[model samples]
Target chain A: MMTLELYNYWVVIFLMMAGFYMLIASNHLIRKIIGLNIFQTSVFMLYISLGKVAGGTAPIAAEGIDTYSNPLPHVLILTAIVVGISTTSLALALVIRIKESYDTVNEDEILEIDRIADEEGSSA
Target chain B: MINEHLPALQVVVPLLAAPICFMIFNNRLSWLFATLVSWLSFAMAILLVMEVRDGTVLHYEFGGWAPPWGIEYKVDILNSYVLLIVTAIAAAVFPYSWKSIQKEIPKSHHRIYLTAMLLCLAGLLGMTITGDAFNLFVLLEISSLSSYTLISLGRDRRALTASFQYLIMGTIGATFILIGIGLLYALTGTLNMADLASRIPALEGSRTLQAAFAFLILGFGLKLAMFPLHLWLPNAYAYAPSAVSAFIGATATKVAIYALLRFLYTIFGSSFSFDYMQVQWLLMPLAIASILFASMVAIFQDGIKRLLAYSSVAQIGYILLGISLVNVTGLTASLLHMFNHALMKGGLFLALGAIAYRVGSTQVKSIAGIGQAMPYTMAAFVVGALSLIGVPLTVGFISKWYLILATLEKGYWPLTVLIIISSLMAVVYTWRIIETAYFQERPAGAAPVTEAPMSLLIPTWIVIFANLYFGINSSLSTDLASRAAIILSGGSLL
Candidate 1:
């Protein structure tokens, strides 16, 4: 009943959790970035869906238009979208550098490598 | 003509100059330009503080469209103090980086470092100055992104992983904040924080506001590295370039704390957050845990930067502890510690950077007999350590005095004992480094290190001197902190 009544919110929550789960569960750094993207996208959708007004058209002045979906949330989402894209790109760039240095992108492998490095650094 | 636009220019000048700084391409020129820009912003922050000294709020409407319609840049005593901290750190760190980054970062990346520094400064100032909620998010990301870049500039490969982890955590935190702001907007149909402040009172017991408040605090908790969410911080601060460690150690988290204060006090109102929501109950426990937990961890850290990084978490706990007390004195202590932390942490990290410059490493073992090697830098480190321990006639002592006073006023005797115990923990951690550097003999075959260059020493001392000066003569800091605290508590400063 809840899902059917508030389907859009359910969709957002579901996507958010899945993305969050993947972000924590993934071993690959790139996958983590992908998960982060999915997570961000869900938030964007939440804003966009909530801005919609029933029976409303685009928020532009017209002779017949009495109601219009709020344009402000859409504007806000646009900015958020830009932020998301930049985060993704920057994260991927970090992963690339990480892969170059550590010779692997698997989280455990990189961590192991760093551990080894720390051990060697201390012992030397 | 310029007075009205000062608030906007406070952020705009550095933001616009960041790209141009990168274009300069020459190393020293880039450093000089960035330093000049930081000083300019610092001066503007000082000016803003002076203007708001009488407790008047300066509102700058973007394009003259007014609040609720266009973006607004608002300056009050609370945020002006934050702006001063952010810009003052940037001013000092930029000059210090002139020499430090040359040694720590590659020549090719020098321009990028300066550019990122300016961008981060602009972002922190913008987040503090803006009256709009969404604008704060945008600016927060701007600062967060640049800081990630800054952290990754360290010569060590571990810096890459540290920066990567920070980016992931920071992005998640920011997205949570965005979702919270969207919820607030959905509830109130506006994004202006001042407007939201007015409308929020009418929506009492609204579950949506409750949800918004929950998301906002959780996100800010992560951003401010409140206790358990602090995993990303120590490594991020530890592996970053020395100048970066100093710059971020001083200002980044302090600004985040300021943002939290704004949301907790101004937008939500202390009554709503404290009385109705009982947020202090939640915050107080976390603050206590961070102090004891992080201080304990600091004692075990082998790396000096990592030690201080853990201590930063403990210091953050002190600020939050003050906040959780829910009175003007507690709030005053929080603001005072924010300023004092900037001075001490900035100086300590700069001193550590100097040690790293000479010793080529900052491991506790690596710095054996370092006091004799680099007398001035070690002396500066000792002073910073003393301040960190809340020794008498230090900034840390003054803030802790106020915090203890605040707790006592609330009949929290146990909390006083806990504060003293935590300060003892600080003593233990700092004593480890001092004993290693001064008391121990230099291992055989070790090269004799000279004192850090005058350039590094001077900037380091600037903050060190400020830390000592502000500690002895606390009138200025106390006045600003109390006035800011009063405003935050919904009281008229006048």
Candidate 2:
């Protein structure tokens, strides 16, 4: 019988795998980006869950708190959240440019166009 | 003040200079500022190497909080060597950019170009120096994001597409790395590499630890462009701006390789990573495949840039082969090849940049007879090509010799033979370029060829000269690489 924490971790792992699978399987680049977000958010939840203490309060040094959640994981997750945002923004920007150039967001179509371009380039 | 702050200043000075370069707002001023910033970083790297040569490690605590509290900038023979390679390539490329960028990039975009170049330098340097795992990922993003911008800024429409592809792949790589770090932190309750190293041993047999290792290797494998996972690389290199190609071809993947080493040896114990888990079993076959497959691909590339791009994949194979051997000598070979690959690949890309500057295209057909007119540039290419083929008296040869010796030491005889055959494949691809450049007749009505400007030629020669110099007198590189290798093999040695 796994503990609650172990169950949380397993759920997170499942979510991560589902996200990765969607990233690989999706034709739409935006959907791929969405998958990446899901993947990252699951990891974020894992981190936050690990930081919880049995009788802990919020990790702020306010009036008369005897116990608190480990502040380190919270602080680390803040940085992770910032990184995730940057990645999402960058992926969005790439998708926009990709759509402009290929007039499509589908991976198979873009790859086909690129392949045709290469063939035309060599034969010419 | 800056003298004592070599470790941080190596990254900071360039990072701050990028915005200042933009603020200058004039093309000439921007170019000058960018060049000065690159030289400043190079000088700082040299000083860091001098300070650490005595084997004393410098650990700079950020905000005066020591390890396990605040971030740290750590430097030893390993990262100092990488710092030198990154900055040295930047130093060489900055001057070359003046002539090359004028031809390839729009005059209006000069400020952005200079700013992006400086940012890329800062990111690579920061990634090399940081001792914290999360800090490493942040710097990795900084460099990876800036590099995508630099690549897309190229004139070709496909440049935009190439940059997009790289962004997708690079994002995946970065996310994987972050997940791995997150897992390690969750398991060990810390993000510092040194602290994690101490904590990891007690949990060696844990499934979480094993998963963390798996994620780290896979994530970094994408970043390093390890053999089967290298699909994103050749096109990215082939389509990026020439100067961008040269700088990244030299530095980006090498920094990833360094990060892999930091995690594998420093954070994860060598006994667990190499011996117990046997990562070599996976690394060995993949490295061999990359060498043969990428080289075979290179032999058929019509464009010089794409040829070198495939060749970069092959070169990465040699580095991994060195690493997979899992001994001090093998590690030395890996480290030495990191430097050696940077010089030769940088030189090759710069040579192609010069031709691209002159002929307006990198298609080999365009440059057939131009070699006669651009003799100095072609000569540099020949020297670079010789280095790439690993001929004696070239830096590439020295690294390959060490790699072969390392394999033999491990009693991998078939592997030794494979290494030799790959070098022969290298010979074929290099000879193809040399034959096309010098022997074949120029296509009719080709433009009257003039040599690449002295600015580009001088910097390209700096690497070419280093290649031969290191090839003959390899003691400096060998000493540092071997020492770093020993440190990586186990903390027990120290």
Candidate 3:
């Protein structure tokens, strides 16, 4: 039982690490947003998994129910999901603007442009 | 009836006004409405502070649900004091934004700008006042989202990248906080902070609880721009619109620091956080490194706003250093520095806004001879700079004095010396700007510049004068801060 419970957390940790690695490693702005979505979704899943109980039904008032899964984490994650969506949309909007202005969505290329601009700015 | 709802109204007023601001498409009307809402919130904050000054904790339950079940708005001296600073800075910044935004932001984006500003204010106030752990995460996101919008509204193209960087980091921080809160809820079976605090003590040895604490610190450390995790701040500040630079510089991280304090001292309890976890050992070195490292970085920055942004990181170090001391005086210094730094940095940024208003640039070299052209604005900057350096008879000195005393009380003389050395580094950076502005001749063929409009000057000077006034007569701040600190440290000021 302990090994199984530990395995559940291990999956959560694996998803978390994978998501974070993508977020940090990706240079493409759109990919970074995707990475952020995955990162946040993994956290949401973690919360939901924590609420799971063996041999439990949905949390609801009923005439006969011996065990019920906790609904609080579900409720919390629902709100977090909304926040996550909003953040992703806003991030995409920023990427759109960044692409328009810098004419590139690659973080490295954008940094190079900014660096050149900075050099010219100081020299001027 | 209204008095009973002050806690809710403090956040609700700005939250509601944000959508209303969006509806008012006319730039002037939208700005007027935003300013009025900010002032109203500021007034409410003052009343709340006065009510809680005697160590009263105002607990307002939402939807008539008792705490540990229903969400609660908890306003004590600690939060009320922070609320006052946040709203006061908003109140001052909004009035100044009318003119500053006119120049920095496009006319078409003005309404959206005002709306985002109001939303950010509401979200910050909500974050500070909420007692539920989950509610704090929601409010944190609200403010974080709006601030990203505000930062991206800057005229420079780099603002886009800056805003995106901040969004990524802020969302990660918020997620970490959410995970921590979720873990705590699983442990305690309650979302309310007071409930958690009561239950946390019994589960002290649990690894999950310990992990939650670590996550909370790491998350809030990112949010507060603590040391090595502060990569997103300087660009965000330097590229953001001038008014935004002032407003967020003055309030956002300050609120994050308040959140850290609330979690560490109030929820986790000082004993668990400091004694069991040894958070001081973890935080102290980071704090010292930030103070030394960020200040050195500031000394080389060409852009004045970027310089001040790095300075803010160093100042945050001082606040955190106070916390790591884990004593009454240290905590008091931290609390006091939060208020004082708001005044000093707010005034400095607003002064920079005025210069940017006239010269259309914030580069140190570009502002040569601004002392002659924009005397009032430059004077304000000089006074703020002095305070930043922690000179005597300024608000900065009071905080540093308490900090040094706190270190002495702990027999940490070397730490005290480090604090003084950081102040000297501040002086060096500040002098670079002063020398460029006052001594260097205005570049040949440069257009003649005038003093910033009275609208900007008045707010800027009000903040600067407050710095001086509070420095000399610090009883009000010290009294409230000491009492709050005592509460946090589980001691009595008396």
Candidate 4:
């Protein structure tokens, strides 16, 4: 049942977990963005792998290609990649602003700053 | 000619208008243009609703490509109603936003704010109308990204952190939805919702389908701010500009509920989702917890917006509770509440925005006795608060009444009691506002405040009147909700 042929999926699982762990475990905002990118990449890989067919050529109208890999997932993944890029850029821009405002990007430190502000605002 | 393309025009009008607002580069002009476009969208939505009133479905193909091959725009009783909710809320928010944003946002960022607002409106509308899974994912991102920009535009530096937190959470949620759509596509090789629905019955026992269902529910639950996953909503609403809190607070999560309904009833069918999967068992406890826990938490929040945000989480629980009932009355209650809550919360936020304009903050204590200073706005807020608490003759009572009936129909006395308890909690939180604003006197020597501008007051009252109007009539919304719920729970609309 442990098929070595599904190694691509195994790789996807590994990368998805690694990146997701980084997203949750990391303190630095920039590192969290990187982790998000990695997590997105795993999904991209998942879609790409789902399109493969044994002995299939590229989805092009060539001379003799009876079997061709599915191209729809690739097209969908392209859109996903664009969305992923926008998210990363927006996230990075927010982090830069956050850094300038709080002067730190560490999650705990930022929370501490906000918490102190909250305490003072309430007490005032 | 236009009527033939109502579904297409419904989304395209606002989608194209976003960039035009950006091009205008003048806040006043852009605001005028965006408001007009939102009205146009709302008009089209009303027309679409009329056409679909007799239980007919309207389909528009993208670039002439038929469904199961290309993206499609589909309209029916359910989505047309949802389209009205989003577009109508936008229509109300846009004019109110013109004045509110002037005070809450910087002059230079005004055009950018207008652009983001239009884009977010378009995105929400598009998400409501699209029948393709991938297209919905794309539109969801479009809305999420614009909302992040909108949230970030607030004057407070904390807006940056709030928007960032929401970005992280929203992105994760969208990705989870994408993963779900990918799995569905892998299983069925079709992105069209109707085609997938027709194909799904044969694949009910597949693990991939189950995983897709789980991912979709989890993803949507996060987006809709269902209880424990709602950590991102409070600060995001609290720190965002007043207009943004009003606009997004009204429309965003409601659209998420529409999406979840589509997946549950239309695509997967209720029997598979409820009977086989038993989603009710998992959903019930969480919904109950949200109703009890979020309401309890709302009683303690200092910021009025934050408190309302928590109440939103609990209101969402009520919606989920209705869905979990899997009965027509239950779903009717859910849909009715979605529309009613939009009016109540949207009006409350706009009134809060007016207060913020006059007083500079929305904290409960900061509003002390200013009720006399801003009688009109405070009155509107009081009506909205009453609606939020389900007082009779307001829209809140209409939906909550149906919810109680739904539970009673199911013979679930405990749930009925729980809902009543939560409504009482709503009274507690809202009473604090009433007492503080009406009973306590404004601190001596505070700047003498005037009423909100006519521009702001008109829209707030417009929404507040709708609450009373809809609550009193109840026929239009109740009729539509009953039919839509029947369609969903029946899984027979297609």
Candidate 5:
């Protein structure tokens, strides 16, 4: 069995790859948003994971307790998660609007329309 | 209380102004309030820069908790320079937005537009002032998200698509940055920039640290629109509302560059970034390539706004080239270019907003013969163009002068010649617009073009005059940029 320390770093890497995969490869607009969510969540996990230490308790004041996980990273990750949620909501809103205007959520179809618009303009 | 509280107030004032903008609900009142707040914040940034100019880093701890444990706002020479640039642009842009927003955005969404602008301002300022790496990511998202909203609000239906594309790319960039920050935290166990600088040397040789550095540079590089990762910038700048384009083009990516600069030298140390990692090897080539690529692409675009958008990418290349030199002169050149480019581009976009307001189109053919009608606006555009082309006695010339000297200092003379040649390319693209505006005669039976309203022209020329003023007497900007460069390269001024 791997030590807890080893597990923490490995888990962070796994989550990172998952997010990158969604961001780079996904086609559906909503799917890409989900990928971004997963990607950001993985960062949260990495930060939280690093804060954990062997034999450390929660970073709260307690009787007869000394060692605790670093609270700073945890605090930072909390703010980051909130920011992630806001960006996700905004992304979803933009997608809804894109769907309404373009009538298709695919990147390539949108590019085709834009290209056609450019061609028509140049021809004019 | 307010003396030490100035840094937080610089951001919090704008943050609070946004919600209040919504509560007022009248578009005109909201615009008035936004302009006032932007000007006030500009004043505060000036005062804060003066306060910190004595080489004292103003460290403000939130809730009375010290740094390395609690989040802190670290105000130093570099951030103050960025603060001045962002707020100065906001102040200059807000007055222009009064009429421009009415013409481009729906009247019903004016409050929304004002709110987004304020939030974007706050986010840019927060990114500049925050002393923590993770905090930098949070502020980066704050600005990026608001910016997406601002861009999508463009009158064009395709604006939504452009904003979505930007959202996708911006999110990926932020994620890469977060991963980089996470890796650093894992190795150093500290998120504060100063603390990380002190602690990272112990983990210098570790693979985790190296990987973290790589991720961080790549991530921030995307945000700053470093050549290959710059896909989001041009389209977003092209499609966004005029006011949005002017502000973000001037400040957003520059703030990201500041974040990159902070991370590279302040947190990771120059020895690690420049020597051990040799980041310049990659950055220098990409920077030179982007200058050529983006400028060439810009020259070919038919849409005037799209042309300026591509030009912004090329300007970013110049800033990066300065940073890639990894020396005092190079850093100073980068920092000064940050201010000068903002003034020039902001002026150009604001002028376009005026033209777009009067003529009702931003296409090159649409604006043909506008120069005879709106000579003042086009003249301002010419001044801005001259700066972009690095003409003598302009801000761009000062920046390029320092950069060429820096390159020659390192015996990279070929790059210096390339710099001059690329600048000639700038003349070509800028002349494209000038020729379209003046030399081309008006088509018969077309609608008569009139000058833009005083509101827009006043702000546009303010930025225009700023270009000339700083170009002539660059002692202030140059001094601050030099101090910032020293602080950055010295590794630990705290």
Candidate 6:
């Protein structure tokens, strides 16, 4: 039982690291958003996993139900999921604007353009 | 009856006003509504500070549910003081935004701009006042999202990239905070901050709890723009619309600092955070580095807004240094600096907005001889700059005086010298602007310019004058800050 309990945490940790790495390593803006989504999803999973109880039913406060999984984490994650969706949509909108202005979604390319522009600005 | 509901109304007024502002298509009407709601919130904040000034804590449970079940709005001396600063700055910024936003942001986006500003204001106030851990995260997202929108409203194309960078970094920070809160909840089975405070001490030896502490600090450090985690701040401040810059520079990071204080002292308890974890060991060095490095960087920036943005980062260092000291005078200094920095930075940014309004740019060279044209605005800028440099008879001076006294109390003489030396660096950077504005010859063939209109100039001067007024008469600010610090540090005044 203890090993199984820890296993869920281990998976959550692995997914979290993978997503964080992708968020940092990717230069493409949309890919970074995907990385953020994955990262947030792992956190959601962690919250849900924390709420689990053996032989527990849904948290409906029904008659004769002595054991129930925690409902609070579920509610918290529900709010978090909404927040995550908003963040993804906003990020995509920003990426669209960046693409329109800089003609690229890659971070390095955008920085290069900005560097050239700053030089021109200072010189002029 | 209304006084009892002040805590809830303080946030709800602005939160509800945001959607109403969104519904109103007219830009001027939306601006007026935001201004009205901000003033209303400020009035509510004042009443709250009065109510809680006698070392009383006001805890309001939502929908009449008790703690650990219902969300709580807890206002003590600490948070009420922060509430006053955040709402007061919003009130000042809204009226100032009218002309500044009109020039810097497109007309079509003006309604959206006001809505985002109000939402950002609401979220910040909510974050400061809430005692529920998860509610704080949700409010953090609200402010961060709206602010990203507000920053991208700047006419300059770089604003887009700046907002994107901030969104990425801020989302990571928020997620880290969520992970930390989840860990705490899993361990303690409670989300009410007061209840968590009581519970966290028993679980102090657990590795999971330790990791939660680390995550919370890192999360808020990023949000507070602590030293190395501050890469996203300067660009965001420099590229955001002038009004957005003023509002966020004054309030957003300050509220984050409030959150840091709340968690470290209120929830985790000062003994565990300061003595056991020895957070000062990590925070003090980073604070020193931020002060020295950011001040040096500020000296080299050509854009006035970027220069001030870097200066804002350095000022955050001063506040962090105060917190690291972990004593009554030190925490008092940190709290006082929060209020003082808001005034000086808010005024400085508003002055820059005025310059941007007439001169069409805030580049150092572009504003050459602006002193001769916009005398009042530049004068306000000069007063704000003097305060930034910690000159006597200014709010900056009071903060540095207490900070120096705090270092001395800790028997850290070298840090006292370092504080003085950094203020000298501030002198150099601020003098650069003064010289360029007043002494440098206006370039030939430049369009004739005049002082910024009364609408813009008045709000800028209000903050500038407040800096001087509070500096000369320190009783009000010092009294509240010291009481709050005593509560936070659990130490008596020396």
Q: Which residue pairs clash within candidate 1?
A: none
Q: Candidate 3 — number of clashing residue pairs?
A: 0
Interface RMSD of 3: 0.6
**Selected candidate, larger DockQ, 2 vs 5:** 5
The DockQ values of the predictions, listed in order, are 0.89, 0.55, 0.92, 0.82, 0.73, 0.89
Per-residue lDDT tens digits of candidate 2, residues B1-494? 66667787888899899889889968887898789889878888889998888778898988788788899899998999999999999999998898999988899888888898898899999999999999998899899988988888887667877786787788788878887898898788788889999998898788888888898999999999998899889889988889999999999999999999998889998888987789988998999999999999998988889999999999999999999888888899999999999999999999889888888998777778776889988999999999999999999999999999999999999988988898898888888778888899887766687888888889988888998999999998888888788777764335
Docking class of 1: high
Model 4's interface RMSD: 0.7
- DockQ computed for model 4 against the true two-chain complex using alpha carbons: 0.82
Question: What local lDDT does model 3 show for residue B292?
Answer: 98
Q: Which regions of candidate 3 fall more than 4 Å away from where they truly are?
A: A5-7
Off by over 4 Å in 4: B491-494
Q: Give the least accurate 10-residue stretch of model 3 chain B, judged by summed lDDT.
A: B485-494
Question: Predictions ranked by DockQ, top down?
Answer: 3, 6, 1, 4, 5, 2
What are the per-residue Cα lDDT tens digits for candidate 1 across B171-234? 9999999989999999999999999999999997999999999999989999999988999999
**RMSD (Cα, Å) of model 1:** 0.9
Model 6 Cα shift for residue B280 (angstroms):
0.7
lDDT of 6 at B450: 93
| Model 4 lDDT tens row, B202-273 | 998999999999989999988999878999999899899999999999999999999999999889988889
Candidate 6: RMSD to truth: 1.2
Model 5 Cα shift for residue A50 (angstroms): 2.0
Docking class of 5: medium
User: How well does candidate 6 score on lDDT at residue B213?
Assistant: 97
Q: Which has the higher lDDT value, candidate number 3 or candidate number 4?
A: 3
**Winner by DockQ:** 3
CA deviation > 4 Å runs, candidate 6 = A1-5, A61-64, B491-494
Clash number by candidate, in order: 0, 0, 0, 0, 0, 0
lDDT of each: 0.93, 0.88, 0.94, 0.92, 0.89, 0.94
lDDT, residue A3, candidate 6: 75
Query: Model 2 chain B: which ten-residue window has the lowest total lDDT?
Result: B485-494
Q: What is the TM-score of each candidate against the true structure?
A: 0.99, 0.96, 0.99, 0.99, 0.96, 0.99
